[model samples]
Target: MNKKIGLWDLVFMNVSALFGIRWIAKSTASSFGLGLGAIPAWFIFAFIFFVPASLICAELASTYPRDGGLYEWVKEAYGEKSGFMVSWLNWTSKLFWYSSFLTFLMVNVAYVLGKPELAGNKIFVLVCSLVIFWVLSAISTKGMSFAKIFTNIGALGSTVPTILLIAMAFIAVIAFGYKPASTYTVSTLMPKLNMDSLVAISAVMFGLSGAETTANFVTEMDKPEVTFPKAIMISAALVAGLYVLGSIAITMIVPTDQITASEGVLVALDQVAVALGIGHWFIRIVAFGIALSVFGAIILYIASPIKMLFGSVKKGVFSDSFTKVNDHNIPVKAVYLQAIIVSAILLITTLLPSVDAIYNVLVTMTALTALFPYVLLFKSYIKLRKTRPNEKRPYEMSKNNGKAIAIANMVLIVCIIGIVCSAAPVMPSLGENIWYEVQMIGGGLIVIFAGLLIWKRFTKRTGFKESS
Candidate 1:
């Protein structure tokens, strides 16, 4: 039997999984691009959209503590086919997300190299991005032990720089008496519920999301029912605090209009460095840390989804090929297959007119893909509560079943509204149209359907036999 991870390990892993280095940079950059008012909107959405989602997950994770996480929970509640679809959508989204992170890593590398224009050079970014992706892929293929090391290192490496930068910004503000470009008024602080604001909020929500992994980690946890919910609450609180304070720090140092989607965090840090009489070398170090953070996220993107793929295969939902493993207990074939898809995405991105254009599409698509799993998970939670009322659950949200279901439903409704409204075509002249937005959502649906079709065909041909 595999050794169960202790309570502390589970907590740390859950926190690491939820709060990656890229999140800080991405959230900060998003605020700059969306406007300062957008920050509060994200806060609202996070509390309403994310908190309920976490609660739903807590109930599900405790009820169905298993290795496959979402795949197992959905399968138990719905069916194997639906579960496979959820996992497939998630795994597929990570492929494109990994490509986006690679772009982010390359952009930061250019910033550190003092060749900002190189980030826009598709060939350079693509080649360098592939190298980074493959290197991480190699490490991932060694085993989960190796991947866990990278996850811990990457989480710390990326998080320290963000916290340090936020601290430095505060010191700069106090020591130099720097004032923000805009006042911190109620109007500036609140997020508008308008179409454009809502869309931007959706993008930010994607950056903030990722608590669903708690279900996967529960089986490894020492006392999952008790410890897991505490960890989820702590992680959510910490992430919310970091995002709000980080955005304020960035706004204090740089004008919102000047924030670019790709390099916004680095740009803010650069300003802080100059203000504090810090040299270019020091700023470059921070940029390097930022790059590493994105790199770490890319590494997780490479490693996390293989388990889902393998689990689906074991359940006879996917082909036997995905179940193949190497001496190191790594899913080498799945890693390579995902890498190929990610590489293809990088190539397709190069053909796009601009990095921002490609990024917008990718970000939107990633959000849409992630949302599908949430919908299924929430539905599963409601069903399981009613159908399996007497099942042992380490953690129960409330003594009253009605209250728990109502809270879960509220969270689902808020997230659904946020996601649907954000997908509408409303962003200013970045060529965002109904067709493009529909393509993003439609593409995700197609991928999910395709997975279902493949699973049906595979099972029909094989007589639903589980492979050794």
Candidate 2:
């Protein structure tokens, strides 16, 4: 028998995949420019978006605990063509998403070296990104056993620092009497219903995602039908709770004006340490922790999606060579291919006019592309429920088709909203630049079309006719 993944390991794996503290900074920094309002916004999105998506994903994963995850479920419900597209979007979105993670890692590295200004130096950021990407890529090819070490460390990096920050925020406000930059009134907690707030929803949605990605590894667990749902529920609660408290902690220290998404966590750490009368060196230690957390998440993400996508090669969807696996059962060639594509993207985006602009665009594009798969995922869940009502599920979201379908529709509605808002500019500066909108929306369209073209070529080679 293959060695089974432990429940704690699975929980940490999901946490490392889904919970990056940089998002706390990102959300508090941009939370619809609402400051304290972002706190309640996290709760709102978690309820409307994260909770339902988690439940639906858990049901789908438990019912079909297979290797390819959403690819298998989607192909079962829709067809091979739809499954391939969903897998493609999931894989491609990671390429853009890697730029954001790489940027976060390097920014914290700059803070660690006591040269925070270097965070904005494009050349510095680019070199560090390349080195880190290649290093993680090489490590990933060694397989999940090696990757899990970082993920377990990442779970510590995420939870311990976040809890420390939250505790420090309380001390700073309650003991030291430092005035918060934002208020904590009822109206202030409520998010404003505006274009800015709409865009902020996209960020929250992005943060709450990766539950589906966890499905990709269900087959690695012992009694996955039981283990997968438990791990997901535990990690989901932990991640969502941390995000809310973590955002509150960030806003308590870092002034809204000084907070940039890329560097907000460092700013919060620096300010809180000073406010608490701790030496500045504390910030550097925390910065190193944040980097480890992001690195762990990146390595796991680096391997999961490619494993799912390349699994299609078994069905003859691609050349036989793409199915080549290392001694560790990882698809080495596909991983290298993903690395080259991301490296090229990282290199190209560095030449763009503004690093900030490029970062926001990459994030928005990732959010937009990421949602397309979830849209299909929710659809697959509902369809599978109706069509396979008798399918044995260790954890069913609801036995009643009406309840399951209603929750599935709720997820779909949020995905549509997220997709629409994600295509708009999140910052005032980018809002003024029409090309930001062009790049955000146009880039999403181009990626979707690229998937369609790939599907067409696959069909031509295999003589498989996709349903119109």
Candidate 3:
């Protein structure tokens, strides 16, 4: 297989593939919504979700460094049914995630255009959001031979804004003696251990828990054992710190209440820009950066798994229509299918009362949908280790099998907890929008069932046996 990927390339891929900077403000806002301290919330989530999950991914990818990633891993460990489910989750999750990230981009664009009201205008947000999604879809329909530049810009786009916010935080402290609105007394900083205080578990996990998404590309790494772990260590640490510091940066400047999920970071940047005498020009620049970062992610995801999934369908029970490709062999139909589903989600989510609520709910829904696959991932890891003790592992967990099992179980519990938090109402009023939450849950079920339904239909159509 071709191996053009290296250490820095892996780092770039992992960073950009995971997420961009919107989480900084979203994490901080969601943290306070739980009445928990934002700083401790970041650390708690990092320990529970980010660190363990990354370690699990490294060991698994090293063991099964196939292009299939989760699908192959779960299939090998369990069976074809499990593999198909995992792949469905992987692909369908993108439908919801794209909606959230694209809405995030539109929010920043509104700031860039000096029209905050545009964010609240559902039609404006929907139009701009769909345009950008389709444009990227068109781009994804061709070879992204220049993907390196996208990863590089994505890494920069995700990090530079956080660094700026952190720098602004310190500058405000030194120049103006800025004090945080939420005090950091030990009690306030400590978690309450209740659902309300931890309702954003999905958001926190959503922000910190996506390194495994890049594992599919691990086959391209020159040395999966050394490079994958090293990249995970460095990128995970940097991304975690970005979340913590960026959240701090936001709260240090913008009040937690005023921080909108989608617009929080931009709002902070705008405030800091004005305070530093830079003005909306800085907002426009960072807005462009934020969009570029997301665009890079958009390009990466669109070009990766959907195409890979459709390729598998070609050998299976699916019709040619589903697997149809353009001159680029880019699964043109799947791209259009993804765009259509995502646009419907965007329209519904934009109907929420506020932009922040829309972004928050979208994030929660994405987290809920995206995370089911991780449950299968970690489970596959432990099961594989137990069932195939002698399997060749290019990289293994730290030499204590007992501790490894403990950590896996802990991560598993955390994963389930996080998913529940995301699906259920994180706050009181969230229940008032019971219909949206129901729709979110229902939407997820429809996606999962739709995958199975398609498989069953194809089996009848093509006589593709389930055993295969």
- lDDT agreement of model 2 with the native: 0.77
Residue 204 lDDT in candidate 3: 72
For model 3, the stretches where C-alpha displacement exceeds 4 angstroms are 1-13, 30-36, 146-148, 192-197, 213-231, 426-431, 462-468
lDDT of 3 by residue, 87-171 (tens): 8888888787888888887877787787877877777878988999888888888766656577678778878888998998779
- Each prediction's whole-model lDDT (CA): 0.69, 0.77, 0.74
lDDT of 1 by residue, 52-109 (tens): 6766676677667666778888888877776777788778877767877778788889
Q: How far is candidate 2 from the true structure (C-alpha RMSD, Å)?
A: 3.3
Tell me which of candidates 1 and 2 scores higher on TM-score.
Answer: 2
> Number of clashes in model 1?
0
Candidate 2 clash total? 0
Among all candidates shown, the one with the greatest TM-score: 3
Please give, for residues 367-435, the per-residue lDDT of candidate 2 as tens digits: 778888998899898888888878887667777888889889988998899899876555456534466
- Cα lDDT for residue 74, candidate 2: 87
